[model samples]
Target: MTFENTLHFAQQLDRNDPLRSFRDRFLIPQAGGKELIYFCGNSLGLQPKAAREALDRELTVWQHLAVEGWFMRPDQAEDTPWLSIHKRCKDPLAQIVGALPSEVVPMNNLTVNMHLMLTSFYRPAGQRTKILTIGGDFPSDQYALETHIQARGMNPADVLVEIFPREGESAWRGEDICNAIDTHRDTLALVLMSGLHYYTGQVFDMAAIARKALQAGVPVGFDLAHAIGNIPLWLHDWQVDFAFWCSYKYLNSGPGGVSGVFIHQKHHNANLPRLAGWWGYDEDSRFAMTKGFVPMAGADGWQLSTPTVLAMAVHHAALQITAEAGMDALRRKSEQLTAYLEFVLRNSGYPLEIMTPADPAGRGCQLSLLVHQDGKRLFNRLVEQGIIGDWREPDCIRLAPTPLYNTFEEVWHVGQILLKFRT
Candidate 1:
């Protein structure tokens, strides 16, 4: 597919995009009566127009039922009990992450869910005490690994093994990661990694990593913070022990929205150690307030507290859009959108180096650019001109042409802006 650096070519691509109509479903941010070209979906996704109605329904329920909203079903509806409202999100979320509905649960924030999952999965014993993770994963995940190890009366320096790329390399090689896992197999209690690196936009081979870790007698987990809605995942088939993701980014729930968790069915009935809460108790006898803790089967057993109904409501709306568009179709568009951006950037003749993998299968919607000089100035200029992409400290600018809202014309315009700034 030849890409042209012209408005007509961009418009032609947009006109032929099957998923183009989905763009209207989102609330695009505007400035001075003009819509900004938003490419920050890697940080926060555009809001779905249906989110307002979804949130309002929950608010209305609260107004009428108050305390009873927890257990009562509305007069008009038979199935949507407030007490089990989060359950409505399970199937759609399961579809997105490639899991059984029972294996997925929408609850808590990303880091908190990581803590909960780590409590159950990261059991260090005898020769197996270390956790292998990427060196510069999202900061919260790094902190979680360190603090969790510390909480268990272990020194993080002794128990945490961080894998880094070879010299002069911006992204990790899948073979290197598997070799690292195998090398430290004896001391590795768990292999924790991000599905898509937040900094470089490199999509790790999660299934291969999981297979390598498990073959070496280690449990593997992924922080799918940047991967969940951005790419297609098959957690169940991959046999991942556990995974967690925030809905606020590619999922587009909202800022600090509820997260989703995936636990393999193999652990559903296991007597795994976990932080206990009433909502995690077996639902049939939950209201009875039983004496002993009998966790509900599957990922629901990992719930720590009552569901955040309002946040989950917004997430539910977002997941509905994801379901309607379908991951396969969304991913197809994402590849084309990202490839177009890459073409434009490479042709702009700017002193920019794309840090993300060149292979389409090895990245998501994001392209992290390593600017040569005055990078921050360039980023600010883009911001001032309403070309919104995020800047990481040091010298990287992250742009994500989100398939749900962003168009090819926007990508072309961004390229023109980059060329203009270079001049």
Candidate 2:
């Protein structure tokens, strides 16, 4: 498809988009009574229009029923009892990530879930003690892996084998990653990697990596923070040992939204060892105040405490919108939006080196531009012009035109803004 840097071309694309109507479901941020072009879904998604109503409903439930909100369902209200609210997100999430409903569990934040999964999955024995991971994964993941190794009385330097991209290459080559796994297979206790890179917007071939590690008799896990809602995933079918992600970014839940975990049914009955809490105990007999900890079957067994009802309400609303639109339609428009943006940037004569992979299969909606000089100034200018993009340390300005709300014309307007900049 030939992309023209013209408003008419962009408008024509948007006009024919089948998911265009879904844009109205979100509340676009405004500057001086004009709607801003929010291309920041990679960092934080724009709020769904239903967020307020969702919150209000829960607040009303708490106000009226108080303690009863946990056990008893309100006669007039439509929501599930607060005790079983976690059940509401599972099916939609299972559909979104391509897993069985019992395999997914929505719980604590990303890092906390990471720690819990670490406790359960990262078992460093006498011969197999190292964790094979990539360089430049989210810092929090790095810290979690490092500290978890330390807590087990092992040096992080010895336990973590970091892999890197070839020199001069912006994105990781698939073979490089698979080869690293093979190289470390002998001593590798676990393979921990991000399914989609947050900084580079590079989508790893999770299926291939998972198969390689599993075949080598090693467990594999993924941090799906940037991958879950931004791209389609098949954690269950991929045979990924375990995975977790936050819902705020692409799922468009509120800030610090609940995170979710995927544990394959194969591991559900295994006595893999975990840090258990009362909520993780068998639900039917949990109130008996038992001495021994017998976990609820499947992923629900990972729960550590009582659930947060208020946060789940907003997330429930956000996910319903995404599930309604479906990943197939969203992915269709996402490829076009990103390709169109890359075309615009190239033709605009800006000397920006896009850090993300060129192939749509290797990337997502985000196009991370490597602005060598004065990158901060350019990012600030975009913000001043009502184009809400994200900035990272050293030199990256990320623009993510999400299919849920962003329009092709908005991407065209961003290019128009870029054309006016002198430097």
Best by lDDT: 1
Error of 1 at 348 (Å): 1.3
In model 2, what is the error at residue 352, expressed in angstroms? Answer: 1.0
Judged by whole-model lDDT over C-alpha atoms, candidate 1 comes out at 0.93
TM-score of each: 0.98, 0.98
Off by over 4 Å in 2: none
lDDT of all predictions, in order shown? 0.93, 0.92
lDDT of 2 by residue, 72-109 (tens): 76786667898889899999999899899999989999
Per-residue lDDT over 224-324 for candidate 1, one digit per residue giving the tens place of the 0 to 100 score: 99999999999999999999999999999999999879999999988899998999899889989868898888899888798888898899999999988
Worst 10 residues of 2 by lDDT: 71-80
